[model samples]
Target: MLMIRPSFDTLYEALLTRDPSYEGRAFVCVSSTGIFCRLTCPARKPKPENCTFHETVAECMAAGFRPCKRCRPTMPEASADPVVKPLVEALEKRPGHRWGEPDLVRMGLDPSTVRRAFKRHFGMTFLEMARQRRLQEGFSALADGGKVIDAQITAGFESPSAFREAFAKILGQAPGAFSSKPLLFADWVATPLGPMIAVTDRTQLHLLEFLDRKAFPAEFRKLQTYARGEIGFGRTDVSDQIQAELDRFFSGTGASFETKIALHGTAFTRDVWRELIGIPAGEIRSYSEIARSLGRPQAVRAVARANGANQIALVIPCHRVIGADGSLTGYGGGLWRKQRLIELEQGYRAKG
Candidate 1:
């Protein structure tokens, strides 16, 4: 069943009365307090002008409102489901543990049922989420300047070689390959959708990609060759600047990126990226449309390739590009993330 969002008056009345009928169906984002709450929240209500209603926690977050502590509006709606609650709690408690069907079976739960429950509530199976967490742990360890053995143990890898293989497969280089003394630095920045790896020098942001992107390894190698500097796990003032900008972006407070970025691409590709940056938030353009805007109407294919060639993610706004037929084309960060980003920017458009 499609759950439509309640009208503003309907939601305000519910909030004033602490109505339970709209418990999970509606949420309130308060501009004055910078927080979101459930209609049933026991805390004091804000003035009507300060309140904006949304249908989901994601929408509230996209508007830059943090969850209300008094009501815990960020809690999953399915947390009370018998099959989901315990498993979620277990995952939280054992984040680094490798979870599998056998583990669910040992817990006297049907693995298939568990998978379905998690996918319905979280948009991913429990095992997939668990693996992502494990990868985060390993990445965090390395970001902290820990050794390969330290990261392996922290990530729950069975052996050094196992950890290195997995790291190389994802990052395109083994942890050991990074130099202790280096000219360029890399760091991890956590985002609402996932973790992103940020590469920067002292002055300009060099690259930023979601850690899971399949092309990241090759992208990293290419950047290393171009910079003629060893890359290491460290942060620069530029990294700090981009992290702050990203925090504001996901919080829905602001979308403008002021971080200086080093654009490493051919002249044509650079022109395409500059055009992409011209795309306004909450708007989309087709590859052919981008080409035409650049006064190269016959270069539609080239526009698409240049879009794909963009190494910087949100800063470049490459996700704003679509197929000529208005279909979402491939994004290196995965189409799912691309969709979420587009949705998130709609909040920006609304506010503007």
Candidate 2:
């Protein structure tokens, strides 16, 4: 996916032009109006200097802006399109069916257009998404220690090979090869920002990361090694603890996270992450400050690299790091989320 930092001028021009290409892909925040609107919003445009563009609605909300009333910016335009609603309803009705191009054509919809529509709205094609839904069910089944074959059957795969292929593609491992000893388990937890994958064993939490983060795969691999097992879906007491803590954290009720975390990093990296947690809520720190805290002021670049390698999100508090100039910098969870997390923590601190 292209990651362009939209400027105020560029966003204003896109809003003026009413670019359909930027419809779901971009959003604009009007500082003067205290509202954020989609690029296609029909509301009166704000001055260029008062406008800010963001990639997601969560970002705008994090920045203390409400959605535009006239544009209803939170809802995607394709959701209001004529054909998509029915198509989505049909898919929901028969989730067990293996959706494909033939199914779309049979429904009197052009396959390519349908595919594009689904991608534009959901970030994945219909078939890929259907497969994901099936796999999610299978993962839930496996949580209860169900047999591999049972999971395949539950997922509606006709053949074992196809089931294995699908399972491997998603979780990086085959079904039968998954460990039964139950060392550490991973499960998806939905958040206001987005869905996050949380992994834990009986003792401590291992990984908690945004599903769409660019470093997700690497984090998964590292977690697999740390847990000494294949990644699979299940829930444990630790998972429940982490989830509850996260709920409180995001709801702005509390910043205290009791989920015991096992850090896998070089000595230097671990040191940097330790200092990251020391940063109080509603406070910001720079890489140089972190390096200095570690008694190695010259290792600013090293500190930044270690911060990027953090697998655990809110628990580790890597979002508190900013550039030396006090500008937001690269964050694997997306800059918008980083901004929101900072704002959320700041609000909590203020309340205290």
Candidate 3:
């Protein structure tokens, strides 16, 4: 059933409508996301230009696209495994239930059997998933200005010591070690590309970057040092303001950022960032070009270094900088995301 050169128009229509007739008959691969899904997948559809049709799951996989979690194209059916679904449902019904072996036994479930099923399908025990949920809640509590004790209780930990131990294990520090004043709160914002961390205070956004960037943790440590250890986990008015603006920008209803930024860098680096902001959306420049504009033609290497050191993504528009011959250069965020971003800006600019 793996056919080549199928009508793009017909499959595109099926994808838009979630046509059941095409559920097992076709798949859609999104070049921007590197993901494949059944025609009936319920996730937000990518733009038509980003889509490619495949007649079989094998063909999709051959093209290097991973099966989407929402559609589960690699599975025998979309319902997921029979054993794992009920366990997942139970965890969802009481995500804060504090799971244990005894609780599984009381629910007419076998502890070993449940563990095997979850491990086989999800690569972790159901209890581990629940614990992660608890930890995430604790993290959210801290980010929302809750005290250490309040965060511990909110995360379902029975004692302060236990909560601190868990938090320290993950973040390499005790929660109380971070200062409460002049806080640079860390929070996560989800976009069509992926989750990004936003660090900010009441006055200005301090840092924003994609989670998968190799230098992200280092950047956070640098910020903590620069802020004189005043960095804590949480949100601020600046974060909320940026979140709304990012939503508008991604949805194509807005084209620019207006939030104030508190940058930590030398004079040259700060100047380079300001130059980045001056490039209009959907346009680009080379490092040599930027250096010339800055009247530092001999400092092209410095200009390139400054571009790579940029901490604030999107708002600073670093993705607009490319190689001299019109190819993409190294982007801190993955190159695919950079390509998708350029395409997005170009599409929006074309509409205007």
Candidate 4:
């Protein structure tokens, strides 16, 4: 799965509007201009048909696109300017500091000015920027076997209630929802497609899905129940392995996954997923074909249902399953991604 990309038209529109959300996540390679630029690049916007979007700068370079001088696509992404640098450095140096406007004032910065500047540049307030940074750091600490007290302190939250409230405010879930010693942990994996949310234990990857799915919240709750509520914020050995394999897969250099996966679905669903994986990279299988292969020719609908129920996206290879008529069918991550994956696989296969 890549960044949660929209249709080409939508991306073109975002490029026209200079949507900052896509700054580094998506790149537009302009054939006419002979260069690729950030979506927010100030150069004269190119025509829509001349635009080709790639998930990473590496792709743009591979396709012979030089970075735009206006947007500086290859540069580090810290709100696109040096203004946020000092504030960010301050937060990192003192993650446990109680950040407030008065503190900014004492630091010789105007409160309203800083807030407006950050809001315009990063789509977040100055304090919000700090909170988010601290939250990620705190989650990292908690994932590394640190105590909750230590996690909060490391996150710069002076009180447990403050930390819990901040966590709940960002995640929209209770911070106390996990077991004392979690058997499962959830962390993020950055991909060319976007970011994938991964649920894993110390040994096996359980669930992996795109972050923007409409059914993600419910899917996470269901995973929590399947893991007997032993979910927390953290990274595991399996997640590290999964990310590495996925990186290779997306780079088109490897088509196999060596990491173990824990399937929490029904027996039929697991069977369907295993069959999906066996279909091979750069190939497609119809639902009926899969049902027949499973020795249950009448279970075509069941096969499709199981395909839909697959939580692990690229690893399970649900996108490999297509309509009986050879049309793209429903994909939890969207059909555009399915089409992209098929094209990618077919292209690699053709080259091989």
Candidate 5:
């Protein structure tokens, strides 16, 4: 297999900043220390002259660098985090347990320390992570057409209202609001970055957004209304197809998303998205550049609005748009994810 890696300077910059977004995507080997560490490693930084970057731990080992004890770049990420490992293991053991700060106290862990550690590793506080997991359980049950009470029990929510509120917060509707027989289906698709909700009809995908995105609820509500409350929890043939394509993309074997997608935007917004789709995997463009391509050089702000209004993620390639100064700007999935996505696509460019 070809080794997919970002640019040398990019990896070096990640090493310098200890950027956690590059955690599994890249590793650094320090010649002076004879060891390799994760980009988020806490060890003292070495001079650039002594640094070598690799795409995988095996490559670092092949280059004669042992894994650093501090970061344990060779181990799975959760194992390297003192606070994340046990808590994650506990979560797996009891998927239905509602976690709180008091639970951290019972485990002899400081709540503040636990919060910071989980956020650093998982991009969410431990309580939030726990809540997401519980919701996943409930969502899965509901997707199978189980009763609301069954989902609440599966999610370990003692109060029915609490489960309903949580579900509403995520999907913009309570369990009863969803149609039992519906024209659209929504299901979770796990990716290397995070879990994304894919809403599709029988053939075309309508919406695809990261679950943790701040804009997801509003976007989903808009989608829900557009579908006339006919969205249900389930998967379609299109869902299976996208999942396989996503697997290949993350595995570096393929980067194509061939599933037919439905566009629900104004004519200009649709045109902007079509232009974004034309951008090569390894390349990036700015809003002004996109506007110029569309023969509306003055529509830079409108181009930006179209970019932000993108409902489908990687498929539409909104992350490919950057500031004219080459800075990453606001991304609905978070800037960290945008940076990591750009880095990942650079590998695809290298392969081609």
Candidate 6:
């Protein structure tokens, strides 16, 4: 992936020029509207301080901004073109499929047209998306203790070499190169709202994060590196324990988590996360208060960053963090979720 740095001057210039070239490459996040827009948006431009640029829709979404209605920043005009919809739907249906040019031809579609359609819609070709999906599934399976061959088959790779190449391409390592130890393992846990990934070692749980979280991949990579190729599938005793606890949590039987956690962070970060665990089910704390509790009243920003870096969702209690003004702040899982989580916890507390 190419890292495109946001240039305010250049992006503003594009906005001013209404340059079609910048339509898919750049987006403007508006502070006033709490939304982001493509450079080609017809709305009057906002001040520089009120504008932030992003390279991808995922980045904009991760930052807690909505797509502008006027601009329709998220779905470019090309995406809505009739030729693309079928290919997009097919890709979505079997994301794990090993798609090639022949596969497209077999499907009675022109490969180049499909590629162009995907590029226009998602900023990547259908092949690339399929490859990424396969890798993601394989990674999840491996983390859940699936055998190497099983992971390969699950990913729809006909050969081990192809599977390994795809895995290394996305995750920077081959499947077998990852940890085979019984240490900490992670897997996707489907929920009503969305899928969440959970990680656990033999004696304690480690991470639980929503699948859609942009920070999730980076955090999982960090954990994989920390495990030094020792991570593998199959649940640890601790993982099973946490799974049961999570079951209770969702079933409304309880909102309590007693799973041991293997926290990975600096002393200060750990302190902030520990405080999050202490927040009552129905209660919340401002970032400023959390910083003060850590004896660093001025470290509110640092506290917020640590909170953002937290991988263990719900369990570590990072969702309890709010803005200083008692407003909902940044949540990796999305603000709608944060509000719902707070409400759920409040209901749980009330019942208790």
**Best candidate (score: lDDT):** 5
lDDT of 4 by residue, 1-352 (tens): 1546676777788999989877667888765444678889888887654567786655554444445667766554554555565776676467557689889888788888888876664455768656544654676666566778887888887788988887654344556765667888887665556556788888888889886666777788887777777788777778777876765576566788888888888899999999998988888999999999999999999999999989888999999988988899899888888888898788557866
Clash number by candidate, in order: 0, 0, 1, 4, 0, 7
TM-score of 5: 0.71
> lDDT per residue, candidate 5, 158-260, as tens digits?
9999988988887777887888888999987756566688999999999998887888889988988899888888888898777767655655557788999
Query: How accurate locally, in lDDT, is each candidate?
Result: 0.80, 0.74, 0.75, 0.74, 0.80, 0.72
lDDT of 3 at 145: 82
- What TM-scores do the predictions have? 0.72, 0.67, 0.64, 0.61, 0.71, 0.59
RMSD list, candidates in order: 6.3, 10.9, 8.4, 10.8, 10.8, 14.9
Worst 10 residues of 3 by lDDT: 57-66
| Model 6: per-residue Cα lDDT at residue 227 | 80
Candidate 2 vs candidate 4: the TM-score winner is 2
Q: What is the lDDT of candidate 4?
A: 0.74
Clashing pairs in 3: 143-234
Q: Per-residue CA lDDT of candidate 6, range 240-345, in tens?
A: 5665676556445568888888889999999998999999888889999998888999998899999999988989888898998889988999998899889878
Question: Over the stretch 173-247, how does candidate 2's per-residue lDDT look in tens digits?
Answer: 677766776577877654557557778877788888876677786677667776677556678788777766765
Q: Best candidate per TM-score, number?
A: 1
- For residues 1-352, write the lDDT of model 3, one tens digit per residue: 5355456678888888999887677788775555788888899987765666766654554344555768766453324676667666665455445678898888788888878876664445768666755655677678778899888876788878888887766544678977777567877654556557788988789899886688886787788888788878766778777776776676566778899998788999999999999998788899999999999999999999999999999999899999999999899998998998998798566876
Ranking by TM-score: 1, 5, 2, 3, 4, 6
Q: Give lDDT for model 6.
A: 0.72
- Cα deviation at 191, candidate 2, in Å, is 1.6
The better-scoring model by lDDT among 3 and 4 is 3
Better of 1 and 4 by lDDT: 1
